[model samples]
Each structure stands twice: as C-alpha cells, then as structure tokens.
Target: MAFVAMGVYGTLSAPVRPLTHGWTLFFFVFNTAPIIPMLGVFAALYATAATRAEREMEKEYQRAENLLLNILPEPIAARLKDDPHLIADEHPSVSVLFADIVNFTETSGRLTPPEIVQTLNAAFSRFDTLVEKHGCEKIKTIGDAYMVVAGLPEPREDHAQAMVSLALDMIDAAQEINESGQFPFSMRIGISSGPVVAGVIGERKFAYDLWGDTVNVASRMESHGRPGIVQITEATRGHLGDEVQIDPLGDVEIKGKGRMRTYTVSRGFAP
Candidate 1:
C-alpha cells in the first residue's frame, strides 16, 4: 500500500507541478523506511543483554556447584539435578577408606558441642584437602569418622594406593593435632578394595553412599585395626607395590567374613 500510494502520489503530484522530482521521489517511497534500521539496532542490543545475563547465571550456578562438589560426589550431584529422588547405582572396582579420630567419643564428650565441631573441623579440613588432592570422592562424615573412596564417577588402577596415601597423611595430621594438645587422640584408617554400589540414600538431601562387602570390610578394618594405622585387605595389597612397606599381619578372623588375609601398611608417603 505504501508503494502504491507513493506511486499514485508521484504520478498525480508530478503533473500538478514540475517541482516534484528529487526530494518528492525520496519522501514518497521511503517515508517510514528510516525506522527499520533503528529497530534492528534495538533487537541486537536486546540479544546481547540476554546473552550476558545467561552467562552470569551460568557462572553463579557453577559457583554453587563447586561448593557442592566439595561435599558430594560428582555423579551424585548430577543425579540430584535430574532425579533428586533417584538412587545411584553401584560401581565395581571401587575402594573405600574409613578414617576416624580415636576415642573421639570420649574426647568430644568432654568438650562442648561447639568445641567438638571446631576440633573435628580442624582435623577434617586437612583430610578434605588431601581427599581432593588424591582425586578420591569423600563419601560422608559420621561424628569423627570420615569415609572416602576412589574410582567412582571415574576409575583408576591405583585407587587402593591412592586411598592409602591419603590415610597416611591423615595419620600425620593426627600427630600434628596431638602435638597441639587439642585432644592428644589418635586416628585409625581402614581401607578395602573390591566392587561396591553407590548412590543417594534419601530424599531430604543428596547423600552419596556405598554398599557391598567392600564397604563392610573397610569398616571392619577400621574397627579391628590399631590407631594411627592403615590396614588393607589382601586384594588391596595385591594392587599395591613396595612403595608402601607392609607388615605380615597374616590372616585375621573378622566377624561373619571368616578368616581373611590382611596386612598393615607400615611405610608410605603422603602420596
């Protein structure tokens, strides 16, 4: 219609007077055309702002995610996003290590709850750093006990040794804590290597967990073993080398598992 109207006006006004040629042609055909480019500019500006906003939101999400990563396993974190109510499947070839402050019950029982948390936090801070450094996923913490593992959400050949190294560092940390005379308590670490299943256990919060004989054995090693010590099963020993010196603990009879071969790792780096 604009074109038709321009044409009609051009023809009629041209004959009306000879003065309607240059500016008349320009105005008639493009009366509203100048606004198009301005609208295009506005759209571009809007799109750029939207993109920037999206990027900012992504960064914030990642920040919170990294904080969560410090606590929960990556696989469990992913599951929490998709199906926060779903269970995580078990992954084989996983190694679980259980480490705890010895006599923590007695120690914490003597202090206030806040003091217990503070002392535990001081100990756990070092443990958590070592866990992340060794690429192991922290399973959970029960009072003074810190559970950890390797080769889940991914796998590695030396998970057993990896956990062993972390356990060594944990023992050193306990000695430091003792020197400080905070509690003068020792810590025990037990590690077992084998297949296990892991997943979220409940709905309120995402809890990354493990199950199977591997988990149970790891706990047993912790319980039956001595303080300031790292114990491993024969299977774990098979996967490790002399970098970790071993003591001939021989086969020890554990509840329900009958007699099982076990060893005490006496020498190892903070590796």
Candidate 2:
C-alpha cells in the first residue's frame, strides 16, 4: 500500500485560474482517497503485530511462573513474582517428614554414580507422587534423603494425618522397589510437628527450605531412626487417628532435645 500526497503548491504556484481552481481541488481530493485505504492497511498490520507480541509475552510469563512453582509452593511462588525480596514466614503448626535411604553409602559403593542416581531417582519419584497425592509440599532432597512437609506455605487442619499417610505410602513404595530386586534400599523415616520458619534462600539458584527446632528435630529423628521404620515424635503422634497403628518406643534420647517419646508405624491404614 502506498500513500502519495499530490502537491497543490506546484499547480497553485505555476498559474491560478479562478475557473480551474475548483477542478484542482476536486482532483486533489480524489488523489487522497487511496491514502485512506493505505492508512487502514497500515493500522491493521500494526494491530496484528501488537497482538502477536502480547501473546508471546504471555507465554514467557507462564513459563517463568511454572519454573518458579517447581522451586517453591504456589502461594510462595506468587508472592515471589509480586516481589523478588526475601520470603520468610513463620508457620505455627506443620508436620515435617524426613526419609533417608538406609545403607546408601554402602550400596552406592557397589554401583556406578550414574546407576546410584538412577536408582535414587526411581525411588524418590514415587515419593514425590505420594507427596502430591497426600496434599503435602516437598521441601527438598539431599543426597539419599527426601524431605517433605504438610501445612505451611498453605495451612491444613490435619497436617499430621496427611503426613502419616504419606509416610506409609513411602514405606510401601520402597518395599515395592526392594521386592523388584533392582537396587533394593530400605528407607528410614522420621516426622515431627511444631513451629517452623520457611523461606527462600540465595540470590542465585534460590531454594525453598525450612528452618527452626522442628526441622532439626525431624532430621534427628530420621538419622536416629531404624531401617524400614516410620518414627514420629509425640507431637506428630497426637494427630494420628485410630485408623493408624503405631508401636510405642518410649522416651528415646534425642540429641539436643533431651529424652522424647517416639513411636513407629510398621503398617498403617484400616481395612
């Protein structure tokens, strides 16, 4: 499309005839008609270009949000998107679960690094599914250890119950792996419920983590727990309903936190 504006200056300057002036004006108006169509075409192209740009930007924004969600909880990820500042919140009540593969170091010695990673991923992937199924948020994984929590980043009335169910599912998942005879590894799990502070750390490669006495105790419980057992603190035990079966392990000495009563649930859930 092209817009050509005819100059009345050349004709007007050359010679002006009163009778021909009206004809000159009419011809000028006729010549400008093509310009209207040219302007319309330009406007349409601009609008199309703008719409495509907006769609591309929206897609990029969605991709960024998904990446953030993978790193943090949905609520936390939204908060981060609103403000990139440090995110720290104190949760008054939450149940944290820690699970570690028993004899990982010894087992790893028998396999290649790639093989160990593959096996660990296979086991942890199932645990990840259980975490999502039970409405719990996965905190992070350290080596052979997987950490998860219920209630915080979002609140739930039955955090402990959700945690117990997830722990049992994890146990069942690990058992299935062992029975498969492919990189068999028993899991030791520990759980604690109380106050905790959750936050995003590091300016680069930020990670969501939990801190405070509750997390520490949960970690200790896992480290001190026996293989193939789901050990839980008294705080967590109080939340488990009659539907679950637990074997009492009275007042085991915990490092840093004196003697605390603990229990183990071998198999859970009612028929």
Local accuracy by lDDT, each model: 0.83, 0.89
* Strongest candidate by lDDT: 2
Model 1 lDDT per residue over 31-74, tens place: 77878888999999999999999999999999999987766776
lDDT of 2 by residue, 100-205 (tens): 9999998799998889889988888888889999999999999999999999888898999899889988988888999989976799999999999999999889
Assess the local accuracy of residue 263 in candidate 2 as a C-alpha lDDT between 0 and 100: 91
> Which regions of candidate 2 deviate over 4 angstroms?
1-12, 15-31, 83-86, 109-114, 268-271
lDDT of 2 at 8: 55
